[model samples]
Structure formats: structure tokens, C-alpha cells
Target: MELKTVTAIIGIAWASVITTSAQKITMYSTTPTERWIEKKYSPDKSPVDQADIQVYTDSLLQDVIGFGGTFNELGWDALQCLSAEERDKVMASLFTENGTLFTLGRTPVGASDYAFGYYSYNDVKDDYTMRNFSIDRDRYILIPYIKEALKFRPDLKLWASPWTPPAWMKVNEHYSQKSSGIEGTDIGHNQLDPNRNVLGNVTGFKMQQGYLQAYALYFSKYIQAYRKNGVNIQMIMPQNEIAWTPCWPSCTWRPEDLAIFVTQYLGPQFEKDSIDTEIWVGTVNYPNPDYIRTFLKQKNAEKYVKGVGVQWTGMRALPTVHKEYPSYRYMQTENQCGNAENDWSALENTWKAVVHCFNNGVNSYMYWNMVLNETCKSAWDWAQNTLVIVDRNTRQVRYTDEYYLMKHLSRFVQPGSQMLRASDKENVLAFRNQDGKTVIVIYNPKEQEYSYNIKAGNKNFKVTLQAKSINTLVL
Candidate 1:
């Protein structure tokens, strides 16, 4: 679908209202009394915590927090999953600044694994005629809902990624069954024996390093086309979850292949075309050590790609990866738990996501299938977890507990906020910003509540965190 997403740069100003009184207002907190104090803040401060801060001028937070929703998935049975009015309302909710929900996106080249079916811009019809291409599939469901959502946020910064190349581009030359986990009768046989090359899918296009370069340019053109239609395309990932190519929907590209494509092919094409969009790599399995090691080792690969996208299994490998590739941007590209055993499990996933990523040095995060059919019916053929799942029969979209947990961090913890070191003596992870603001998030996976000291600067406030809860305190 040709969904129009707009993005704007919004400014925030502190209101002028001050009261001079010794009156004390108290709320429940498990935080110790020695961790609060005023500090300095400067925009140019290296490691932000080192800057001078004007306590009164800056709030501990800024901007609306956000997550991605697959319009195709969410609006699949819109009339069934949500009333026509509720659909509009839900779409509007995404842009409400008070809800602090901002950011809209699109997959420039193709559908993601969470999608109902596999698709791309230049699908192979009869033969490989790349020039005779069109995004015909999206014209039906995904694009329409996205366009409607944009009506709410006229200035939504849109970014995109490609899940897989056209079936014609793979070694199997067919999109349906993949090598990773796809188990079905193969419609097309692997043309070559031993099919062990890192570039597994050797098609007319993806089969060669030079063809990969062409594919990059093809993507750039797609972005430009979208821009012509008023949607601003900001970034691109060469491949999504390149490490463990899934069968539901995915593609595989080894570290050397990615590096060769970036340093040798994609990078030059972007320069030649003057494509302003940034390239990210390894939209890889998050928390996986092998992918990180492989991608990081690729020759001068980091120079071209802006960030390493962590998703699914990739979440476990952040610490090791960050230590080596500290210079590149670390983004939580995709992660969620829709089918979590219970609300607590979902919240735990959120806690693990926010704390682990920030503590390990990830800057941004994105969730998969923002909304899904509660009953799990879509092209990905499988539904594990999601933030909002609507019952197709009842048309009720319930916000899971993870939604609230995400809010605690994403709503208050603004982007560009430097993650400063702080003590974690009580199973509590915390970070202090340059603006004399400290965000201490406590995760009590155990059954009992835990109280601890968060000493920083000169002032510390006594705090208490609920048992089996995630608490974020700004001091």
C-alpha cells in the first residue's frame, strides 16, 4: 500500500511557573536518600553526564515514546479486529503527544517476517524484469491503513528495511521455502550442489557481488519514489535478521558478503546517487554472539553501516558485541512478547529489553508487529507475541502489560539521553544524565520487593519499589 508517513522536528519549551515554598510533597519510593543531586548539562558534553545542567530548564524527559505497528497485520481484519471508528481511534492514538507516541515507519522494499506473506518491490513475474516493477501487493491493505495513520502524524519520520530479496534473487530462486527453518516440498531445486556459499540464494540479482550493488541502488530508487509521494524515508537496513535466515520470511547474507556489499557495492552507490539515507547492517538475531563477531570482523564493514540491529535471539549477545563495536550505533531493531505466558512474563520481557539494551549501550528500539490478531492469523503463519493483539471476532485491541513497561522507559527516557554509569547493588540498573536527572529502573523478578540506595551527585531520596515490578525513578 502507498501509505504516506510524515515526520517533523518538534521543539520543547519549559513553562514558566515556579513556587517558592518549603512545603514537601512525598510519594512512595524505595530509593535510598543519598542518590539525588543537581548537576551540570551542556549539549556538547562528551558522555553527556560531564556537561553543565540547568536543573530548572530541562525536564528529565522529552518527546513521545514510540513502537512500530504493521498496518497489514493490525488492519488485516480491521472491521473484525477493530470497529471502523476504533481503527481510526487506534491510529490516532499513535500520534497523541500526550500519549507520547511518536514515529511512523514503512518497510521500503518488502514485508517483514511478521507479515502475512513474503513480498518485495520487484517481484519476479514470469521472468526477471526488474525495470517493470511496482509495489502492487501493498496497494491493498498495508498502504491504506498507513496512509490513514499519517493523517494523524503529518510529520512522521519514516524508515525502512528489506526482509528478503525477490525469489528470483535467491540461490533457490523461489521465495516460499528457505534453508533455515522452512520445511516444505521445494518448488524450485537449488541449482548448485553443496549450496554452502554464504550467499546462499544465488539468483540473477543476489547471486553476484555486483548484483548486490544494483539491488542497493534499486532500494534507493524505491526510497526516492516514496519521497516523491511525500513520505520521507530516513534509513535502510541491507538485510533483516541476516544471521539466522528464517523460513516464514527471511534472507541470509554472511559477514563477508555483507561487508563486500557495503564497502564494495552499496556504499559507493549511495555516494554516487547522493542517497542521504543511512545503511544499517545485521538486522541480525539479537543477543547472538556469533553474528556480532562475524559482522564486526567483516573488513571495514562497520565504516559503511551506521548501526547493528538486534532482534529475537540477538538480545542475549549485546554485552560482548557492544564491547567490540562500541563506536557503531546499537539499536533494538525488533523484539516483543505478545504470547507471553502471562502479563508478568510480558513485563519481564520489557524489563529485560529496556534495562539490558540501555545498560549495554543501545540507543534506539523498535518492536515487531505493533499490533496482531490475538488468534494469530497472518502471512508469517506464526504469531508468538505482540504489544497489541485484537480479537478478530470481538474487534477489541487490548494493550498488554509490556505496553506500560515500555512507557516507563520510552516515555521518560528521551533519545540522545546519555546512559551514565550508576551503582546496581540491589539487582537495580540505573543511569544518570547530564541534566542532573537519574533514571533508576528496578526489576524485581523475585517475589519480594527490594529497596536500595542510588547515590549520585549530593542528594539521595529514599525509594521503595514494588515486588515483581519494574520501577523507573527520575531524581
Candidate 2:
């Protein structure tokens, strides 16, 4: 989506009030004391514990692209159980301008650990022509959820990642990996085969001549298929996590092979087919500096890659990657899914993650799953966090504190806003919106109340941040 359209959509959605000459400052917070409370601040003076914020016009970072959550199978399944009225309410809360109004979406290209069973669109053997490719599974659940979200904002941008390509494409011919704990799988010492140079758990596609072309075509065909279904996917990645060998849907690729497929096949295919969908280089995890540097140093690295996507352990190398590849767009693709047991600390870590991702060079931030059943458990037997949880027995949909954390920023922060220079103290971030509004998000992880000052643009204010709070102030 273009910035002009983004500004128009968000402007109508945000309903930013203009004062002709002066700017308006509004505060929205998700703290222990208050929920999604909105407070209008007097920019000229301080009402409470306001601080002096200093703004340096010359120092700026990447422009804010957008915010959203993943459209996982589990999330869709949970939504399917919601009553019509409740479902509409949930959609509005996420997609409407008056609610979270998220603009970006992450989708699984095939299956993830979230799916009930392993699956791929082109499961047929020797189907290099991709005649068997179909998104029929998505139609039953995931599509409906995405389309419903589109009802509120048709321009919602989406990107997809594949957890496993296809059994026929991989060396192991296994749609999923045999992790140590999965039941009824071949039992043995699962370890990386150094001699063969393949992951023993779940080897990725055989890096052969014909397979590479077919796989690239698989992606292109998928894009065309979605467009035929009236959905436009804006970006795509080849794999979910290049380094993991999990129990469920997964494919592990050597860094060299991944880079080769992108530069030689996927990149050129997208261009040849005239597909507008961008090729982002991640959803990759566990960043080994040498691992990522290997890909970046490839011949067509600059030509094929539009951005880098990171999650979990990938955040460790985010600074180095951002510093080295300053020209490429960077995104925090997956917000770390906290333990299913939702608590104050989970919310705290989530808040810190948002700051951490943006404070680095991430232009966009995406949560893993939007909603799950009460347990927030995945098909892989592990549990995770989401914006909301639903109870199957009573058909009750309950919003979590994390939902409010998203509202704190997505509710007011506009796309195209630029992250401004701020302190590296780990909890505070400031941004300048395209509409000229200044936004400040402060997260206090401590248990005690603390007061601080944010002085910017020659205006000073004093404020007291509550303990264990997630706060966002818009000026």
C-alpha cells in the first residue's frame, strides 16, 4: 500500500482533529491502575507528573509502517466458535478505526505448529506444474476471518510464511519434523547430519535444479490464487524459521541454500511474473551473525530482498543487522508468544517487546496470534499468548490485558510516523506522526511508582508513571 492511501485510511479512521495552528496531545494508557483510559493533556502546561521531553529534529529513525497480529489456524478456529454478534464485536475491535485498527497481518502460507495437522497446498508428488495447489483449507476458516477483517479495512496488508513446503519437495519426504517428544514417530537420536549437511529432524527442500523452480512457482501460484479469491497479499517469505527443527510443521534450510533460492529463483520469479508482492528475507529466528551475514553477502542480496523479518532469538542480532543493512526495511515479524498462563509479567514482557522491537530498527511490529481458546495452546502441545481468549463451554470471549497493550499504540499511533531519537534506558520511546502528533510510550517494569520528564521541541512536562504500566501519550 502506498503512504498516501495509508495516510488517508488512517486519517479517516483516527479522525484526527485539527486546530489550524496548534497540535493536540492525547494520552492513552494500559496500566495496572487504568484500562484503556484516554486523557487529554494541556500541551502548554503540566497537569500532573509530566516531564520535559527534548526532541531533536535532525535525529530520526525508520517510519512506522503498521501494527497487527497473525491469522493462525488456532486463532481462526477460536473465532469460528464465537456467536455472530460476538464475532462482529471482535472484528471491529481489531480492524475498525475506532478500535485497535491494526493495518498489517501475518499469515501462515501452509501450516504452522498451530494447524490441527500438517498440510500443504501442493501435496501431490511430482506436481511441479502445481496443478494440485489450492487454498481450500484456508476457505473453511482462515479465509473467512481475513475477509471479515477486510470488511472493516479492505486495504489491510498481509504477508505469509510457510512452516514446511511439501513432503515431496524435502529430502526427508516428511511434512513435519520428528522432534524428541512427538508421539508415534520414528524414535532415534535426532541430530544434524554434519556429513550429509542436512537437519536430521526435518530437512528442507532438496536444493536441486527442478525443485527450486517448482517451489518458487508454488509461491507465485499461491499469490495468484489469493488474488483470485479477492485477497491481496503484500509480502511473502519462503520459510517461517530457517533455524528451527521443531516437532510440528517445520523445514530447516542452510543459510547458503536459502540465500541462493531467493536470489536465483524467488526473486527472479516474482519479477518475471510481474508479481507486486515483495520478498522479505525472514520470519527467520535464532540469528547467528555469521548465519545472516552469509545471506546478506550473497550476489543478489541487494536486488531481491526488500526487508528483514525477525522474531524471538532473532532480536538478539537485530541491532547488528539493522546497523549493517540500514537501507533495507526491518520488521519484528513475530512477537514472542508468552506462556499460556496469562499474568501481569506476561503483559510486562509484551510491553517491553514492543519498545524493544521499535527501539531497534523495526518499521512494523506483528503479534503471533490474535485469539485462541481459553488455554491459548497450540496444536504442537505448547501454549502461547494472544490478544483474547475464548471459552468453548459457555461460548464466552474474554479480552486479555495484552489487548489493551495493543490498543495503547495501534489505537492512536498512525502509520508513517517516524521513531524519534530517545534515551536507551530500555522503557521509553518517542515518535512524530505524519499528522505532526508526537507519541511517547513509556513502560515501567518496576513495582514502584516513578516520576520522569520528557522534554521535546522546547516544551517540558512532568509526569508520574504508575508501577508496571504500559503508557502511550500522543501530542
Candidate 3:
């Protein structure tokens, strides 16, 4: 499919007048040539066709936690390239009530693939006492980025997870699991000696008591330090992608070993320190259901885990895992990061991902890389897509198609909204806010414009959707 215009139609229907033709509805559309153009329409007095979509307001599902994106070091550095006023505008568009109103955010505990370089909170070898543990490095980049967002929305919920543990705490004694260069490049991504022990199928983290105990202390200190800095990290995932052994700052974990660590060390440490941060099992990137089961099936680990986070291939495991563990909260940890194209195809994939996760019972959804420089390349030489891009030379900021796609839902779907049942046709999603406002988001992929007859509660209305566009109707 070609990258075409996306038109969003927002309608407000009153409960009293919903069944009458006198009900006035407003429409707002975004096209490639024009963005968020407003028009007016009224309920059809006489209809010739059956309802194309049926919304069941009585059938409510998960309560939305909210929408958000990650705060990466590169994203922050990209914003630094823009003028102060431009930077503020971008921040406002992301977090302010007048904008997308993102209420949740994810931050890396230490170095992620997007970081300027590989490092950790405590690099001192075998510091079992954790006396050297400090977030002094975060003060330079991550902390400021998080603090700025808090300025716009102080209650913005934050979660954190590390790409890898400190080098000394790992069996490989390196920040990365791989000893070789990235697949397509000759550049070695880390300083791991090629002759030394490279992490294999085993858990990269040392399973000994001393390492496990100190690592748990690492997590507690992280939470305490962030709280001291006025940024309350509400959640912490044990690791980011336990199955993948990437050349970047990464660590692989056997599910059984992770279960043991969380059960005996991480969980008990948090309880001992009186830290209120919730522990979650994720951001799982593997497709195998056994990885999740190996963790959650352990009753002790399940006791401390409040939720599960899934991303990439892990999405395939979400259905099975969620089916078995329905009571646990679920989240789409990271949206698939495309190849920095930021094109319509990527937007379509994002929409499909959003639908799949919400339909499968995720309470919250998160996008990766909120912003990036024009090059879109990470410090480790990997290129990825982002919602906003800044041109370093021109000092210009541009919001990609994904940004508007996110706004179509996040701007209308408030935090307390409940997911309402809607017919599976036409890529439709329905939600009802706490204030009794109903929101229907639909996408028309056909080349020809189609008119849809919608049934909500006892009321019925018709909306004509644009060709190859996404529409949001609010009532």
C-alpha cells in the first residue's frame, strides 16, 4: 500500500440526542496536504443500509493506564540540537493536556543501545557492598530528560529496566554478551575480548549468592536514587529482552535462572529496603511461551511480579501467557522500531500492533524512541524509527506520521477510559471515558471512501470515512 493521507474524524454525540437527526457532530481530518481540518455533519435522518460496525458499551474490558514512549539518551541529545523554544514545543506536544497527554514512560536503568557509550551505575568490579552505586551518570542525560517531562505532567508514570547488568556482575565480565562485531558492520560494538569467555546459552548474570544479592541491592539503590531526584519509578522489569544476545549493551538470561533471581534476590531485596516499586517480568522479546511460563509458573516469582511486558517477537507469546495468567497486568513494552523510514507502512504496522495488544488484554502501550536526530542512528550504529526527528544542521523538528497515528488514539482515549467492545470489521476500536464519552477509532484501507453505519448503545449514526485514512469519532 502506498503512503497516503490519514484523515481523523472526531464527532461528539450527546446521549440525549444520539438517536435523533438533530444531533450535531464535528469532524476533524488530517491529510498529507492539510492537517486536522474541521468540518460539520449531522446524524442521518433516514438510512438505506445496515450498521457496518456495532459498539457494545456494556462489554468493557481493560482499563487504560495510558499511552507513552521511551526516554532514550539519543532522543534527549537530539532535542538538545533544537532551540530552547522548539524543544519546549516538542515536549508540550508530547506531555501537555492540550497534546497527546502521554501519562506513562519507560527509561533504561543504565546504558541502552541508544546510549552514547556503554557504561553502568557501578563499574567498580565486585562491589558487593554497593557503596559505589550512584546515578551520577544519569544526572547528565537521563535524569534531566525525565525531569523535563515531569514538569509538564508530574504524575507521569515511569518504569525502568536495564539492557545489561554491570560487567563485573555478569559471567562474561563484559557489558555485552557478544564478543564479535555487529552483523553488517566491521565495528566491534563492545570491548569484550574475542579470546575470553563469551556468553552462551546460559544466563549472563552470575547466579552465585553474592552477585545475586548485590544485584538486587543495585535495583533498590536505583529506585531510591531516582526517588531522591524527584522521579518516582513506579515499575522495574528484571531485564530488557532476556533471550536475545545482541552486540550492543545486552545480556541473555535463562528463564529458570531469572525466575530464581526474582524469587529469591530481587523481590526479597525490594521488600527489605521497603521500596514500593513494582517488579515485572519482561521486556521479553522471545516468541516461545515457555520463557514466560518458566518465570510466572514459579509461584515465588509470580508473587512479586505485578505484570508482564512484551515486545517484538514476544507479542506472539502474549496471547498464550495472558490466557493462562489473566489476573496479571500486561503492557506492550516497546513498539516495533522500524528502519528509520517513518513511512506509512511503519504507521500501519504500529496501528496493527496497537490493536493486537489491546485486544489481547494489555492495559498500557508504549512506543520506542520518542525522538531522534535526522540520521536516526544509535551510538552502536543501528538505525531506528522515532515519532519526532530533529535536523541538527537546520535545527528543525518534524513530527512523523506515527506521531499523528499515536495522537489519534492518545488524545481522545483518557487514562480512566475502559476498552469497549466493537465489531472486528474496518479496523475499529471502541472505548468509553469516565465522563461517559464514547470514542471510536477506525481505519479505512480501501482506495475508495466508505460510509459506515455505527451502532452505539441504543443510538445509531453513519460516518463516511476517507479513502486510505484513519478516523476517530468521539461521542
Please tell me which predicted candidate would have the highest lDDT against the true structure: 3
Give TM-scores for every candidate, taking all chains together and pairing residue i with residue i.
0.75, 0.88, 0.93
**What local lDDT score does residue 180 receive in model 3, on the 0 to 100 scale?**
66
Q: What is the C-alpha lDDT profile of model 2 across 1-475, one tens digit per residue?
A: 9999999988876664334225555666666557876666545544334444455545777899878988878887887788888989988989887778898988888888877777899899988888888999888867787898999888899999998888788876776555453444443233423343346333377888788999999999999988888889999988888787666777887777888899999989899999989988887787665667777898988888889888788888887888887888888888888777566667778777787788778898888878889878776667888888888878888778888888777766668788888754377777787777777777777788776676766555655677788878876
| Model 2 spans with C-alpha error above 4 angstroms | 1-24, 44-58, 182-203
Ranking by lDDT: 3, 2, 1
Best by TM-score: 3
Q: Which rank order by TM-score, best down to worst?
A: 3, 2, 1
Q: What are the per-model numbers of colliding residue pairs?
A: 45, 19, 0
Could you tell me which 10 consecutive residues in candidate 1 have the lowest summed lDDT?
Answer: 9-18
Please give, for residues 120-146, the per-residue lDDT of candidate 3 as tens digits: 999999899999998998988999999
The total number of steric clashes, by the backbone 3 Å criterion, in model 3 comes to: 0
For candidate 3, the TM-score is: 0.93
